[model samples]
Target: MSDLRTELSTNLDEAAWEWLIPHVQRDAVIVVASDLDLLDVGVAIASDNISSVQQWIDQQLMVKPSNTQVGNWNSDRTKKFHTLILQPYVLVQEMAA
Candidate 1:
C-alpha cells in the first residue's frame, strides 16, 4: 500500500478503508460517522482540491444530482466536504488501549 493508504487505514476500519483507498486523495481529510441507532453510516472526504473526490462520488457512490458546493465554516477556509451514506460502524478510538 502507498503511504496515504497506510495512514488512512490506521484511522479507518480495514474493510471500509480498503474500499475507499482507491478513490481518496493523498492529502484529503476523511470523516466516518455512524448514527446512534447503528443502522447507518456516513463518510465524508474533504480537501482543498476536490475534483477527484467529486468525480468518485458522482461515478462510484452515485449521490443524488445536486449542488456539490456545500461550504464549511469550522474547517479550513479553503477546503470542502463530500459525503457518502452507508451501513453502521465505529470509526475512531484509542488504538493501543
Candidate 2:
C-alpha cells in the first residue's frame, strides 16, 4: 500500500488530489481510472458506487461510432469513451487538517 501511495503522490496532480481529498476515506481502498489507457486496461473512473458506474458504461457502450466529439476542440481531436473495470488497488485517503 505504501508503494501505491507513493506512486499516486508522485503521479497525481493538485487538481486530482483536490477532488479525492474530500471524498476518499483514509485507510480505505480507492479505485481510479482515466482516459489515458492505463496498464493497457483502457480508461476508468473511480467511484464508491459500482452499479452506477456500470450503468454509465452500459449506456455509453451502446454508441456505434465509439468515439464522439463534444464541445470545441481541434478538428483532428476526438474523444473515445472507455470501459470501467474494478481496480485491484486500494487507496487510503490522507487525513484532512
Candidate 3:
C-alpha cells in the first residue's frame, strides 16, 4: 500500500556499523544488495510478499551479514548502511560511497 511504502520510506535511516552491532549480535539483520532499492524490499517484507522475498533470498540478493563481513565492519566502525527496521528484522544495505 502507498501508506505502508511512505511509512517505510520515512523510517529509512543511515546508521554506522558500530550502531548496528547490537542488531547483528541478535541475528536480526538482513542485508539487501546495493543494486536494489531498500524501500521496495521493505514493502515486500512488510506486505508478506513471500514469492518476491523468497526469490531475492534464493538469489542471495538478501542475506544476513557473514562472520567475515561482521568482522570487517567491526574493524571499521566508520562503515555506514541504509537501515529500515521491520520488527524482528533490521533490513540493511551498505550505502554506496
Clashes of each: 0, 3, 0
Candidate 3 global TM-score: 0.96
Sort the candidates on lDDT, descending order. Answer: 3, 2, 1
Pairs clashing in candidate 1? none
lDDT of 1: 0.30
Worst window of 10 by summed lDDT in candidate 1: 33-42
How do these models rank on TM-score, best leading? 3, 1, 2
Mind giving the per-residue lDDT tens digits that candidate 1 earns over 1-97? 2453344444433332334333333323234222211112122332223664465445543232222311222222333223332323232211111
Alpha-carbon runs more than 4 Å astray in model 3: none
The digit string of per-residue lDDT tens for model 2 on 1-97 reads 4454444444432223333323323422232233323322222233244665465456553122211221121232332222222244332212222
TM-score versus the correct structure, for each prediction:
0.25, 0.22, 0.96
lDDT of 3 at 8: 87
